[model samples]
Target chain A: MELTIERATKLQTKPNWSDLTFGTTFTDHMFVMDYEVGKGWYDARIMPYQDLPLSPAAVVLHYGQTVFEGLKAYKDDAEEIFLFRPDENMKRMNDSCERLCMPTFDGQFVIEAMKQLIEIEQDWVPEVDGMALYIRPVMYATEAHLGVSPSKQYRFIILLSPVGSYYAEGINPVKIAVESQFVRAVKGGTGAAKTAGNYAAALKAQEVAEKEGYSQVLWLDGREQKYIEEVGAMNVFFKIDGKIVTPELNGSILPGITRKSVLQLLRHWEMDVEERRLSIDELLEAAKNGTLEEAFGTGTAAVISPIGELFYKGEKTVINNNEIGPVAKKIYDTITGIQSGDVEDPFGWRVQVI
Target chain B: MELTIERATKLQTKPNWSDLTFGTTFTDHMFVMDYEVGKGWYDARIMPYQDLPLSPAAVVLHYGQTVFEGLKAYKDDAEEIFLFRPDENMKRMNDSCERLCMPTFDGQFVIEAMKQLIEIEQDWVPEVDGMALYIRPVMYATEAHLGVSPSKQYRFIILLSPVGSYYAEGINPVKIAVESQFVRAVKGGTGAAKTAGNYAAALKAQEVAEKEGYSQVLWLDGREQKYIEEVGAMNVFFKIDGKIVTPELNGSILPGITRKSVLQLLRHWEMDVEERRLSIDELLEAAKNGTLEEAFGTGTAAVISPIGELFYKGEKTVINNNEIGPVAKKIYDTITGIQSGDVEDPFGWRVQVI
Candidate 1:
């Protein structure tokens, strides 16, 4: 795959890394590829990150025909840049593309393009604990058509933002509101895929939770609003009787990469991992009886965010009294170590960028 | 609200209304408004229909923090423009805005701006058999932030597209594929809101149905996947044993205005309109034994589309054999007549623009 590079017209000098916010500051360059019905995906390139002039009738702006994937690049003690299981992200992106009717590109081509862009913005990758470059690959329908059907032309673009630790307090647990009134994903929906609509749909509940002083909203199954699905943007897991329990691979819950990795690590550590239909009643009962040792959410940004308390049905149930559980701490350490290359990666999940 | 009207820099001289697809053709002007956190929504104007220059880091392009409402302006026999329940559409738009964490605007302000735009593009309203000027009111996060939090800045836009008759062949019934694999909206999600994400999530399944030789996919309820929820962009209803049955207003289904109007019309006609949960299995049983009289989808664009056949699990269930049912014909006639000013709108739904 040939690449065409274009440097930004302007670049920041002496960029401040101390107060950098996640997703606010972006790198100077962005990777782009075009897809058309007759020619398929082509014209892959890394160009200067700038404003895109879009027709008023573009499908994405109107119909929300967009999908995106998020992963991060870590700078290790050896001063090397590495991406953790980028191919997995690429594969998941393809899955999302198929669901959104977007043209899929080769995973290797995207990975290579990402590495090139990371190399160009290597200096922007902050060298701080829990700080790394967050890579975002977005595919959108760019065709200037107003039809409700899928677009014939599309654009795949990648951007990078150096994000600090998602939680400012660093692994300190958070209060999550169990929203029985609102469900995030329904069965046979686009909840499993990393589509734009899933996130957009959750913003309202998130806003309500934030107003109530909660970090995120824990969504239940849409039909009955009883089964535990996910927490806003992350997949959820529970620890009952020292057994790792997560919701089954229902079409509604996103099959997160970090979630998969955590399950593998638990299995490798000889801990029993059970993927089943986890219900809210079961979790509440377990927590009340002290059988639930821990509860956490997993995603690319936050490896594991411990759930301190759950507000559900007008009742506040403190799972662990706003403290991070041991299992959560252990998983966080193991995953962060693997990502930073401080520990031996037995599964070979990391791919070196430079 | 002070208005700024800018005529289009260029217009399609030879307008092709004959080959006008659904949303492909646009008028010469559009309505726009801006909203910032501190100042609220302001700067309402009618601007030239042109490209929207968006920053690379706009939040709508990433998080899908957007919502929209659809209505239409119809030209009567006297060449007068009339809007059907535009205030209802405005209220629904703000309801969606609240769900999406977007700033709300006054209904009158939006209506006033829309009236100006309609006056500018009054000629675009087709005078053919079943044609109207489609109005799309959209609100999205325009902040240049990368965080997943609610945006402090937003853009509310109104676009006009002159659409031809939804059914070119005079409203022939359609075939629907029962999608047991994909779900559109979940409880506690943005299912009730007219949000962009919900539509984005349905594109893939809609494509699959088309490939399977169906016009649309019938979405089942998220939890059970047994209950009928909706069809692509439309609320569904079935006539079973002289009763009009539709899914109950759980938090997951959009409160379609057309759906509400139809139910009212049915009730006015002395038909029993029951807004309750209708199971797919029950419908199938009814279809097998001839209890199912007719099935149709209701939305803004396609006022009512009769379902000719239902394909579920590799079985074909014909509904009235491609003939529009008696109840459906009445609904189609009453709604289109009121919209075209051929009948009196007793509910005070019509708002004349010119």
Candidate 2:
């Protein structure tokens, strides 16, 4: 029930943030905890990041009983780091564990531990204009069994990586291909849960879209293949006739944190917004009628990613003449500004760690 | 590539045959190989079975980019081991790789390496009447990056487990519940592939069924939730009006190896069999008309698991007076007989080792 810290013997020299690839570099220390069925979670420790000595038959390797969360820590000009809505991420992680039949941990306890970790690794935070310290929390089954049931043992780990800017270049609109061959998730599947198998099942579709010269794939509903589900790993929004429109939180779609923030901001500003089922046919028709004004994706990694073109079933529809629209740009600037402590924290979403 | 063998300095004590669990007990050695993007698969070796040193950011531990296969090695009275349909398992493993966007390997080469592993762990095979050694072949992404895409590195492993007899208390009919809430898989999803996420997704439903006094949960179609899909990870079969019927391979159903063998055996014996769409309504109607005869599930773990009762929304249907039928008995006996070399294997499915 007590947290312990064991420092590394030696630290490696830090690399230039601009030249580093996204999520490939890490800090010196990581937080780890173990859990058993009757024993609950215990032995919390901050240790040096190194190879994990796992059993050859660990359940996560063969059964995919794993869950993960992604967020970032941004530094203001005065050298203080803030994490946005860390509580929401922890709650969502518990939801994922319940869906996967795993155990749940205390949210406040983990947030406090994360703060301790951030305080120790304060110097690792990037000073670059667009970069941040990426936080990755992962929990997986460590039971060395070949049975296809819920595991009795588990390991929870929180890793820190000094990531490069998601938009190294300017925030340009990207080309997306509407996928009809593969479905990302179904209503009765693990789509709403941030588990590993959903992403693994989507790699083939993404690979095919990449080969066809598309930046990402826009998935439709698995049952009907009509309603829009997600664009790549992020939630999508479309502006039609000066109204912001996004798909509702159905069972098959992930509830993105950025997507929720955008909705809250839109409602606070008294802007027109609609959350309902938006089909691909309806979207394409709106484009033909000149009502489809803007399109973009929202997620933690990029914050806001504009969509310049969409190709589906041998049909092409360009939006806003292949440029970032005013609404999208405004939302991006506001959200990022709030994260870096440059704007008013009306919602009080950001929590200072150091 | 050539396979190098590194024997362990101190061998582990062989576990008691009857006391060992199904898959927790393992032999002394294992086979491993590596794969990278530019370079093909290399560094094949048969080494001691121990802990696997893995990176904290390995793609498989987080993203679930993994595939696997299962089979058993049976020993006859003459001290010779028989591997039934190893080639089929190897080919299916490659199919699983293609579906998950992972790299494929030489099936023949892996099979040969497995034979060598079996030879080295010959003494570990159980001599019990129904006991055998289970072979698990697993492939998973090993790249140490946090990107949600296809990994650049992977590892393939083969492990042998000395398992106890599944029918230690004699084969008994199991009660199954028809699941309407949580569907196992949907069409155009990763249902057909032997991937880990699919199993992880089904655990919640299985756990609920077990608590309600059911041995397994029978899955329905995701789109309509009417037609039958699978029964607790195994393919299902029904006997109505003297005809053997099963759900067709409609992309959402796993192409089970044991299911194929059953169909072949039924056809070889000139029995009536049908592979088509079978809705739950039609099946329930058959049960009401006093024509429903038998039902069973097929898989590598249990060659033929008979179903005695089926539970649906406030309705219960009993089959064959809650007993195994004549046809089900014949199929199980024939399959087990062929596997143990007591009956003629006309299909040449049994490959010899040692």
Candidate 3:
């Protein structure tokens, strides 16, 4: 539990905060720890961000044995910083580690480590309206072997990237295409885990969707290809018959932290919210019958991505006249407000780091 | 493709050939190539085997945008090195690239590069009866951006390892457990691709099966969990009522090179062989009636692995009295013979590299 600190002699010039893109720039330092079967996790330190020297036979390169988590640190107008539900992210990362056969750590310990990292990089956090410092915590197998088994050595790293909008069209409704040819995960697969392989398997579908004039692809279940699962990298929600509905976590869907917060916030606000299996047929029928009110995607990157149009089976359905719905706007405003300390934190989800 | 060559001044001591394990040892030289979005694949070179410097934000480290292929080079009594169907491995690697959204290379050109690499490292190939040099060709995203998309930069590397046995009990009957709880892949997932993500997802189940006294786990279809998909990382086959049967290519199973060669060789011998869906219930029923004669798995690593026992649903069925079946023995001997140049070259598979 001893954490060593190293100060960089010289820091690189920071990027222009006003014209920031997603995940392209890094802060001055990074948090790192090494794990060996006999030595355990040691050498916890924050050093200058530099290149990682790995063997050609590292398991993470050849076998994809990696798990990652994403969260954000926001700066209020008064220059105070807060993290939105980072505990949930670390807990979920452990679940992902268990699923992917990687090692896990105490969630609280990692959260404290992350707090120190953010505090050191406090200058990187933007005080703008819709911007924050994105925190990426990743653990990967570093064993220099090509065997098809779990690694005996690992490396845990935490990186900080100052980002603006996740997508190019920031805070705007995005067009989505329902994908039937490719699947993200199956019931017995690694869908529930926020691991590297799940995202790697999704690139082809996402590329195709982008080429077809859609911002993201809506994934269907692998078993039937009839039920909704996720939208691109986000958890999807639908407003049907004046009630909020989303796909239940059926061992194959990612349990998004933002999706959970949205549900909790909706319920706390006395809105009708339910987690159950909803078929594509039912949703499309609701859209045809004027019962589909709004549809949006929730994740740490975008927070609330209002899905304006859904194109499935060569047909397009526009939701809420291709405009942002009141529910989505309110959810985004409330969550972002809480993160910036502008609104009351009734759920205690925000962690004031500094 | 202009290739560059860099020789090492001091060579590292090679491992003992007789005491070799899979993918643990490396040769003196490795083939490498780089790819950029607009520059295409360039900088093809054979350099000293060294550590690969990568950024923490490399897409392969976080999102698993990687694809790899495995083959072997054998040296006969005259120290003549030969490669078996390397073209197929490169072609399949391209297919895997398409599935994982990675950049593809000219299979023929890559094969030529591999031949040159083997020539330069000819002294490293093991000259034993049961041992040879294992060749690993892997390509991964090298872009230091954190976005969940196809990387703009990549690195393809070819590594050689002197090895002996792929499994601990080499050439012996291996006990396998039928896994119904955790599935490997479905029709629409990355099941057919030789990518890192698929292997990462299978480790958990493999670890569980190994702890339960089985060498590997037999994966069923991810959708129904009924029909058998694969045994461990290899393709499975069964002899029932004097006919050879294997699960058909349903898009969720890897099309193993050895499995294809086995089918072709069986047909050349005028044996009754078929590829179709075979359910576990039917297999167990046959075992109950004494008609399930023999079962085996096939892959490049093991060549032909005889399955002596199958454990499923609290039931254990011994195949062929827990011994290497006659058919499996013949196929293994034939394939290994062709690879070593001891047998007649009917399929024109073996390519002399040195």
Pairs clashing within candidate 3: none
Candidate order by decreasing lDDT: 2, 3, 1
DockQ of predictions, in order shown: 0.68, 0.86, 0.89
Instruction: For model 2, name the residue pairs that clash.
Output: none
Task: Give lDDT per model, in order.
Answer: 0.86, 0.93, 0.92
- Best model number under TM-score: 2
Range of the 10 consecutive residues with the lowest summed lDDT in candidate 3 chain B? B163-172
Q: What is the TM-score of chain A alone in each candidate?
A: 0.97, 0.99, 0.98
Clashes of each: 11, 0, 0
Off by over 4 Å in 3: A165-170, B165-170
Instruction: State every prediction's TM-score relative to the real structure.
Output: 0.95, 0.99, 0.98
Question: Candidate 2 chain A — worst ten consecutive residues by lDDT sum?
Answer: A122-131
Cα lDDT of model 1 by residue, A18-37, tens digit = 67777888888899988899
**Candidate 2, A216-324: lDDT as tens digits:** 9999998899999999999999999889999998888999899999999999989999999999999999999999999999999999999999999998899999999
Name the 10 consecutive residues with the lowest summed lDDT in model 1 chain B: B9-18
Q: Is candidate 1 or candidate 2 better by DockQ?
A: 2
**Mind giving the per-residue lDDT tens digits that candidate 1 earns over B217-242?**
99887777888889878999999988
